[model samples]
Target: MNRFLRTLCVLVMLAVVAPALAATDVEAVKQRVAKVDVLRGEFTQEKQVAGFKNPLRSQGRFVLAQDHGVIWTTLKPFPSEVVVTRDRILSRQSDGSSRVELDGRQQPAMRSVNAIMFALMSGDAQALSAQFTVKVEVLPGNGWKMQLTPRSAMLGKVFAQLTLSGDRYVREVQINEANQDVTRIQFAGMSDTPTTLSTDEGRRFE
Candidate 1:
């Protein structure tokens, strides 16, 4: 083929391939996040109130199971653990006391947390779409970023947005919520499959 013709053909091919590749990457990101079952990691949480003079900082370990729930345990700057399940929230303090908040039966904020947990566990894009305008962007070096903005007024008041970033190995979930609260969690060491929490652990939040 002529040089010009060959170059033209290559360009046409790239034009078609590029968009398909981009769409595939977007789907891959969704799939990658959906497949995560159990996630255990260390995290740094920073909270800024609307009128606070300083941001509160804490270090913690996070445990999440797709079926059972999420346990956020803060070990530094005050020890506490928040266990979340389908039914309720169990918050335990370093003093060995616990408070339980019922699921849909509780306050608005608790219900919101339950909704978030359900969405995370189900990986239901439709459910999430109702509350968040989500976009997935693949970054260089095989990394990805999923950004979510609140679609509802209530969600907006509670959670401003969330930006999650991670690579091919395991996904890192970073949550940026209302009032400048940020949770940066990286999942480095993971099991081959998602694990299920015991009945007791799952009911700890009840």
Candidate 2:
């Protein structure tokens, strides 16, 4: 796999698993997520690998539509876009050339990745529990924190743990990999109102 896809796969996997949580708390988290139909935000991402002295940094904007899926556009450190839907994953370069594309029907893993990402973004805790052990904690103020550990040995070998913190929507994601690599992503300027998609953004999904 390419660097981008590999990184994305790991990140998406992180979104799907959690430790263990009380039934009520889990339900609460789900309710909070259910209120959001569309999510738009900007993100800063830092990635640290064993041999690098400095972490790689990237800035991006993302839109997650409940019906259309996700459109992630990275504008800094080189331009690229990744569109992930229930049936396909498409990657494009700054020049608008295709980098990679995967059909879920042809690839089971792709299908699972899509499902997991939707569940995570939507805060469908019950769906996540089917795949991972989940633990939830109330934060100091208004938010909640969640930790996810993979159930499959194969997945465990890829990620040590994934921690997510947020109130009504996901605010931060921290990923610890078994290979000693780490990634942290912080999100800001989020909104869910005006749930409709623009014409250009809608085209990406098709």
Candidate 3:
């Protein structure tokens, strides 16, 4: 074949193959996520504002176990923590004040965290779909972004949408709420960390 013709054929082949390769990668990521037992990482939450001259922000790390549940422990701008366990939710402030929500029915914020964690751990699209419109997209470097938009009038009252970024392992999450408030969290080195809920860690939250 002529050089120009050969080059043209190669380009056409790549154009068709690229998308299929991406889809395969996305499916593989989903499969790996479904079987994940634990995930741990450092995180930072950046809250943004447009109208206000100042913006609010926070930082944290998280440990998530599929069966045991989630922990969001902020380490910056003051130390604080939030835990969502199988039975209850716990929040401890920097000033030593603590709040507990049992059976997932105490605070709206707790409920929101629980809902998002459930969707992430269970890989249940329907759970999120009940509240948010879900769009799964292929991200750069074989990663995935699951964007969620609130469907319920009640839910939209608190937040507008949420975006979860990850690969075969979850790497970051952003919860974009109403009032121009945005919480962006980036997870680092999750796969290497152990996320088992030991007796000592469990007691600390309790």
In the order shown, the candidates' Cα RMSDs to the true structure are 15.4, 3.5, 15.0
TM-score of each: 0.70, 0.83, 0.69
Q: Whole-model lDDT, candidate 3?
A: 0.53
**Candidate achieving the largest lDDT:** 2
lDDT of 1 by residue, 81-128 (tens): 666666655566846575544444645555664665475456554665
Q: If both were scored by lDDT, which would come out higher, candidate 1 or candidate 2? A: 2
* Candidate topping TM-score: 2
What digit string (tens of lDDT, one per residue) describes model 2 on residues 9-50?
Answer: 764443222211222237666554435556677888888997
lDDT of 3 by residue, 1-99 (tens): 223222222221111111112222236545534254565666655656557766666666666566665566767787876666644555567455765
C-alpha lDDT of all candidate models, in order: 0.53, 0.69, 0.53
Candidate 1 positional error at 167, Å: 1.6
Q: Candidate 3 regions off by >4 Å? A: 1-29, 32-34, 94-116, 192-195
Positional deviation of residue 84's Cα in model 2 after best superposition, in angstroms: 0.5
